[model samples]
Target: MAPSKKMTFSRRSFLKSSALASGGMIIGFNLFNACKPEAKLPVDLSALNYNDFNAFIKISEEGKVTIFSPNPEIGQGVKTSMPMIIAEELDVLWEDVYVVQAPLDTKNYTRQVAGGSQSIRFGWEPLRQTGATAKQMLVNAAAARWGVDASECSAKNGVITNVKGDKLGYGDVVLEAAGLEVPEDVTLKDPKDFTIIGQGKGNVDIDKIITGKPLYGLDYKEEGMLYATVLRPPAFGQILESFDDSEARALPGVVDVITIGEKVRAYNDSGKNSWTMPMSGTDKVVVIGKTTWDAMKGKKAIKAVWKTETALESSETHDKVLLDLLEGNKFNTRRQDGNVKHAFANADKVLERVYESPFLPHNCMEPMNFFANVSPEKVRLVGPVQTPEAAAQVVADLLERDLEDVSIDMTRMGGGFGRRLYGDFVYEAAEISNAIQKPIKLVSSREDDMTMGVYRPSSKYKISASIKNGKITGYHLKEASINGNMYGLIPNFFPAGAIENYQVDTANYKSNITTGAWRAPYTNFLASAEQSFFDELAEELGIDRVQMHMNLLDNVKNNPDANIEYSPERLQGVLQLATENSNWGKTEAGVFQGLSVYYCHNTHVAEVADITMEDGVPSVKRVTCAVDCGIVVNPFGAMNQIKGGVLDGIGHAMYADFGFVDGVPKSNNFDSYQMIRMGQTPQVDVYFIESDIDPTGLGEPTLPPIGAAVANAIYAATGNRINKQPLINNLEPKEKVLG
Candidate 1:
């Protein structure tokens, strides 16, 4: 792995430093700070200030420091973790530091996104440099004031001390630091010196979250803001023909009724459409009312007509298409090595199996809501969105305003899981506000949120392996999905370089139903299928499952492919850790265990599932996971992420199911959609490998392997292979559906 770049800072000639109203210092730096105009500092030194950069630190006269976190916090703990990185280098007391969320600033910040678990991975070095530069400036100021060489002064815990034992608090030199030139270079502390980065810290928003304070988008309110409930088409292929709002208008607190979708289409037609634009079908009825309840009631009162514009898709039809495509010769080759046809034909034995997964909704607890106010002068938006920069741009395009004129304030999200990555709800709110020329908060009911989601694409994987002389000689993987195939990254992962004659082919059937990133994206299900297949392969070869994995890893390590994306050493470490901690081959009688290891989202994780008989059915009792994501920024937060990911993976694989019938979702609410309850949740124990490598992602990596581990455990206990999800359908044969 490449070491993190050593960042440098220098004084910009065009910009002038200014003092705060209370005469404190505010230091800010960005990679492109020299090219951009100076950011205007806020007058109040105590209040959180928005400056241009990844992040900035503020010093008050009372020796208190505030760090503004730039990225969105979608319950991933970046709001707390990112600021911790800054404070660690700033040499400040963790208790005296306060963290605040920064607003959207495209000109000042880059990669201000919260997807793919890249927040900390990308923020690691820049945030460290930000704090280190500020600390160096303070030290320089103190040295200059004391009439001593800067090299003789050292800073610790917000205080500067000289060689002679003279000391000064950061606050005492704040004004001097503000006027001094920024140091060109500062050395970062070694990993051994870190105190706050590795320590456990409570979430910055935990208090407010538990106390029911206003933080999420649903809790936001504005003066004279109207509540909106949109009535969309009931099915995927359907379009809104017309709606009569006579009864809706008569309802008390109903302000008005309007239609949107034409403007969105017009924007797309204008040739400015991009991937960031909303893929959710257009055409909907917006009911404006005084309260969310009134708007929802008004929506129910409206009578709407819908007409199908395309073929009404059904799950049975999708299943048939996917299976047929797998058998057909037409396919797009994703990866190819030696000839697989020749190897399979000459092999002594061949094993084949198909794994299937259905579409899944994100099921975010807060639903979808955004506050938008469109005036002739500017557009103001406040909500929980993962991609605020994209949301602002799309609204700007729809309203034909300058991007600079649109401002977005990101609120803490109840849950994102990749649903908020799209800006469909944001543009809808902007459209509604612009139509009425008033501020509006668009709220989606649980049903609406589930039915209108950009779901995880339903997919099937046909994996076949050829064996010769009791050794695996070839491997082939065929994938078929709705709208898309597995991302390009997965084809280059493990088992790719391990096999000599490897081949991967993919085919997709495009559908009107919106499908996009969901949590770990395709890896969420792919890992489960791939891991389960590996276990079966091990059994077919008459080798211990753990030993087989070690051998394959050894192959990759000895001779690696140029396209490989994972580290064999790291993966081997986690697998060993997890297996040892879980007592892989030494479980007590009546207890069956399965292991799975995977690398994704730049992190390596290994999971072991323990299962036992309950009421004559296999039950997951506990899950033990080992992770190697370089460094653990916050142990408590990292553990929470691992536990959550493991549970989410097991829940979806075991019970969560979604299907479409005649273009309509079969499960639109909790009553129909199954989720793992607290009682059914397994005990998850997580252990992290200690390393000096820079930190990687943790939010999504732990999810991929857990499903496979649980499925393999079930197979071990019941002697029934689960090739389909939800695993419940196969475990209970009566509930199974045939293509």
Candidate 2:
């Protein structure tokens, strides 16, 4: 349990490649790459190795099956669920087949990152195939031992049985089967006979989790491991100029204070700074200590110089900049259907609305941290990463080593929330490890985590509709401040020629706040703008919002009018159930109602929130959600995720906001950056549409609707739309704003 004392490492190698060795069984074989395709290769089986380890089964000499999952187990319960996929296929009890966070090895892991709510969805197919293939091989091995036909043998619960009732445990037969050539093109079990795939499987480690077992990135420990505190730039275009580490070096437990000059390469063609901090790769400050608190306390005394922004955007001037740009009317042609302008010009009545949103953050429970022991020849990285392959490349680049030398071990995450997608932190760890020539555990203080977090970008939506005789003939959308990465992916789905008489043009501008993927990314903001506008559009036409969406679904259900990639039937089903369950329009009193539907992560969801004014605030009394994520696996977990996501999204919309002063962020802690408490959670009702479709993702599917749903409700109550984000009383007002 003590950290390995292998000190042969003179210079930290950012990439560490070792052979596959665990529990006494070593399985290694053919790999397809630039080098070899038809050859059997050696691999490292250690807990954290960069070598190929496609083998799923690791049998102990005493007989226990361990399944290695290449994906990180962020708090979405994937540590429990992804293992269940292998267990279902391997026919082992959840406890019997232990799960280990997979190491970074490209040959063994495909789609190793656990982001975009893809842990379960991505592993579904391969895990199934793994189980079926293993079972088949075990059956074949048993049949040969019994001198019988393979077809007459059956495999179950890690055992192979014959017609005459001969049986053997999986471990007893693997050695024999390992020698035989694995059959190609093996058939899998039919859905009707899936004993565990579709059945309710609980979180395998619920007891450990509920009892406070050490199972998170924050809880990991290594002997002689030094904690590091990094000092980064406060804003864009900032650079380190000078520093004095003498006072820091004198502090208790202070090992070293490093001034690293991190440089990001500019594009050869454009020759622009790739980014400001992580993206731009500014040099950093490293404060080493025996403990996190000591390191942080000592970090303050380490004086350093930094350059202020040049030719840049500031938070105070960002709004004005976008407003000025809007007047210029420069927008990309996202979608164009019919003669939208002419139709709007000739319409009997026209409705227009504008909505605004503020910047956001992904405050994950486990602030970014990665444990690394890097060297120029090889490196070892152990952390929770969404993209293991990408992390591999990063370590290789940072250490200036061969890609094959880098090793990564993905641990279970306390919470990913899409924040783990960025591998920049991993780069820092590798850099510091290589710099100090010692293994280092790079950690971010809560302040560092919040202030330097890649924030969700803000935007404004301008929607216009042409209404003639109570029928929508044309629609137009002009969205501004669309600087988030979603802009790159959105146009591919909803570009020109998707809808009739429709025009969608978006203009992007810069802001002081940094941007990264949040839950549902653009959908989080898009739903709030698009859905709320649609709700108002339906009201103007005096039509039910559900019906209006259904009309749109009709267009996309068969042949999608927009180039959007979503199953219309699934989306419509969510709307169908939400309307039916909420007793739509069949209730009375001062209750405010709002409805919305959006699709993401291969799932569709519709939500209807019922609200009533409580103490001059729009408090949700109840919410009815209808979701169809294909066939449910662990239906209870699925439902729990839906319930949890709805509440999380609700809290984020109602209270979560990250502000800025000059170049630094304000409200950097939980005390100021509040989250939704249990007391605030409303009565929630969730319904999963009955279907035979394979299960879809649930982690991010429920978040996109909350902001729009709540905003719509507040509008119904006061008839004055609340356009901005963090609908709260906490703020630094420009015109001395009021709640």
Q: What Cα-based lDDT does every candidate model obtain? A: 0.86, 0.69
- lDDT for model 2: 0.69
Q: Which regions of candidate 1 are displaced past 4 Å?
A: 1-18, 31-54, 486-489, 560-562, 732-739
User: What TM-score against the true fold does each predicted structure earn?
Assistant: 0.96, 0.88
RMSD of each: 2.9, 7.3
Cα-based lDDT at residue 621, candidate 1: 92
Q: Where does candidate 1 have its weakest 10-residue lDDT segment?
A: 9-18
Which window of 10 residues has the lowest lDDT sum in candidate 2?
Answer: 7-16
Per-residue lDDT of candidate 1, residues 1-739 (tens digit): 2344456555551122345777677765553343255555454545533434445567887779987778899999999999898899889999999988888875656677889999999888767877887888889999999999999999999999999999999999988888887677887878788889899999998899999999999999988999999999999989988889999999999999999887798887888865655454468999999999999999999999999899999999999999998899878898998889988999999999999999999999999999999999999999999999888888898999998889999999989998899899998999999999999999999999999888889999999999999999999998899987436226888888888899988889999888888999879988988999999999999999989988988888877453689988888999999999999989999899989999999999999999887765667899999999998999989999999999999889989999999999998899999998998899998989989899999889999898889888887877778899998777844233110
- The residue-by-residue lDDT of candidate 2 on 1-739, one tens digit each, is 1221111111111111112333223333211112233324333343334354443456554446776655677767666666666667667655577776656666544566677777677666655555555566667877888889998988777777888988788767765665554555455555565566566767766777899887766777788888888888766557677788888888898888885544234221235322312455456788988888778877888888988755445555666655665566777777577788898999999888776666777788888998888765678888877777877775665555788888777777777777788877787777777788888888887778787888777667777888887777787877777373354225323212324678777787755456877778777766777788888888887888888788777766555445667766667778889999999877578788888788777788889889887656667889999998876767667877898889988998888776565666767788988899878899989898877666789988898887788888777766666667776542233233222
Query: In model 2, what lDDT does residue 188 have?
Result: 57
